[model samples]
Target: MAELPKSVSIREVGPRDGLQNEDPIPTEAKVRLLDALSRTGVRRIEAVSFVHPRAIPQMADADEVWQRAAKVDGVRYSALVPNSKGAQRALAAGFTEIEVVVSASDTHNRRNVNRGTDESLDDIAELIDLLHQAGATAEVIIATSFGCPYEGDVDPARVAAIVDRAVRDGADRVAFGDTTGMGTPRRVRGLITAVRDRDADIPVLLHFHNTRGTALANLLTALELGVTEFDASVGGLGGCPYAPGASGNLATEEAVHMLHDMGIDTDIDLDALIEVAELAEELTGRRLPSGVLRAGPRTRLTASSG
Candidate 1:
């Protein structure tokens, strides 16, 4: 068995990645959700994304939402930017931490940004430089890192090469996204090893989806490999726009519960997180796919009569 990490950092992406696929809710509702999540003791939150209104209509109010959200002290808030234009918008909105995405699969990349994988990488390089020059941090998220719905079983080498290029282009950090939730333990280990071999110093974050019930398992594998950062959603509220019927992200409550029980420190209040998850479900008007939300945490016990 591999040695478990003493603690981990969970970046809550529900406000951005989780809500980007859902129906457009009122701006006030978005602010409410963000405020509720801020009080959950989660140190990092991906607040919003600055994308074209036509591309992701759900996030059309990114500007207003960010401007209205009650900024919390001691909490680091970030947003996603699709290109140079989105990066500029995020910077103008006074965001210092920004994320940009590129897909490992060519087909997925073309479908996501209407550009080939190489072209998207070139764009990412330029975006990273622009963000750095603006005194901002840039994080590159490689979508479809595990497997692509359109193209099954992505090669690990391709993913590592992308990581190499992103680091060379001055990315502050990089995250691997299991976009379609096709990650397994073996694949996760191989991909991490490949990336580590290329640049062990690069900060890595894993984003998993529970589509096939392997998100937690893959997370465990990455944990054993000394990966201490992850991206999860509150109430499991995200899915790929192009992949039909795929599940949302790994639930924050579920991850917190498991980590707490295993003696891993996440510095998150489980009950508070559950409450936020409930609020997310209520706001979306949909039943979220959260195991903890349905079945309470493992620590909950009932007294029995003799």
Candidate 2:
């Protein structure tokens, strides 16, 4: 087995990505969730997205949520933007770390943002400039990097080309998203290799959904490939509004438990994270699909029969 990195950074996207698919919660609840996540020792949090209210009603209160959040001392917060307008809104909300997303598959891109792949890339190039002008860093997230529900198979070379374009347009970092959880170990390796072959210096983050039960396997493969940054949600709460049949994101507490057992450090409090996951279940009024939440962590013990 390839040696794993000593430590990794897990960005919690529960408050934003996780809640966007559920029924709209109160702005106060969003603020409370952000505050709770900040206290869980999660260093990075994707707090909100500045999209139009009609598009994602759950995120309609993005401005109020950010204004009311208890920004912690050591935790870095970021927000997602769909276009130049969204970027401006995020900047106005005092966000220094902003993420913009474009899809690798044209069909998915069209369905996601009502634009073709090339059109979104063109917009992203301009959006990157807009973000930089406001003294904020821009990270481009490539959705459906592995495979697309609409397009079926997404070529790795196509994903590489998108990454190349985003990097050339001055994106500080790039994230590969398994938009419909269509990633396996082989697909993850191919996509990472393709991206690295194009640009080895750009920071890479992996966002996986457990829709097909391959999220953790893909994470392990990325780890072996030296990809250290990842995005996870508390209580496995997330699904793309545009992608039908897509499930929740990889569970944060479950990932932390596996990483800790492997001697890899994520600096996240597993117990505290589980508590937050439970809170998420309570808030959503549904049992989330998290293995660690259901079966307990690996350290849990039971009495043996004599």
Candidate 3:
């Protein structure tokens, strides 16, 4: 087996990507969730998106939530934007790390932002320039990196070309999102290899959904390939609209548990994170699908059984 890194960084995306899919919760509740997550020793958090309210009603109160949430020391926060206007909102609100997303599938891109893939890339170049002028770092997230529900199988070269354009446009970092949880170990290797073939030095992040239960398996593959950064949600909170009744993103507590057992450090307090995951369930009024959250960590289980 290939050696895994001694330490990994998992950016918590529960507050932004997770809640944006559920019925709109009170701004206060969202603030509570963000504040709670901050205390869990999560080093990085994707806190909110600046999209139009009508586009994602659940994120309508993004500004208020960010203003009210506690900014913890040593924790880095980021916001996502869909366009130049949204980028302006994030920058004005004092966010230094901003993420912009465009889908690799043209149909997915059109459905998401009403623009073709290349057109979105063109816009992203300007957005990157806009962000850079403001002294903020721009990271481009390529959704549907593995496969697309609407387009079926997405070619690795197509995803690679998107990465190429984003890199040429001067993106500081890049992430591949398994938008519909369609990624597998094979697809993960293919996509990462394709992207590296284009730019071997660009920073890469992986975002996987647990829709088909391959998120962790895919993570392991990426680890072997030397990809360290990842995006995960607390309690497996977010579900893709395209794949109803399926599992959400990989659970942070579960991922932490597996990583810790492998002697890989995440710098997250697993017990504290699971508590926050439970808090997420309470605020959302629904049970999440995190096995580790429900069953406790391996050491905890072993101790109890003993």
Give the least accurate 10-residue stretch of model 3, judged by summed lDDT. Answer: 297-306
**What Cα-based lDDT does every candidate model obtain?**
0.92, 0.91, 0.93
The alpha-carbon lDDT assigned to residue 215 of candidate 2 equals 89
Better of 2 and 3 by lDDT: 3
lDDT of 1 by residue, 236-267 (tens): 99865556566779999989988898899988
Candidate 2 lDDT tens digits, 1-306: 899999999999999989997777788878878899999998999999999999899999899899889999999999999988898899999999999999899998888778899998998999999999999999999999999988898999999999899989999999999888889999999999998998999999999999889989999999999999999999998755555545669999989999999999998889889988888888887678899988889888877986
- From the highest TM-score down, the ranking of the candidates is 3, 1, 2
* Alpha-carbon lDDT of model 2: 0.91
Residue-pair clashes per candidate: 0, 0, 0
Per-residue error for 160 in candidate 2, Å, reads 0.3
Candidate 3's C-alpha lDDT? 0.93
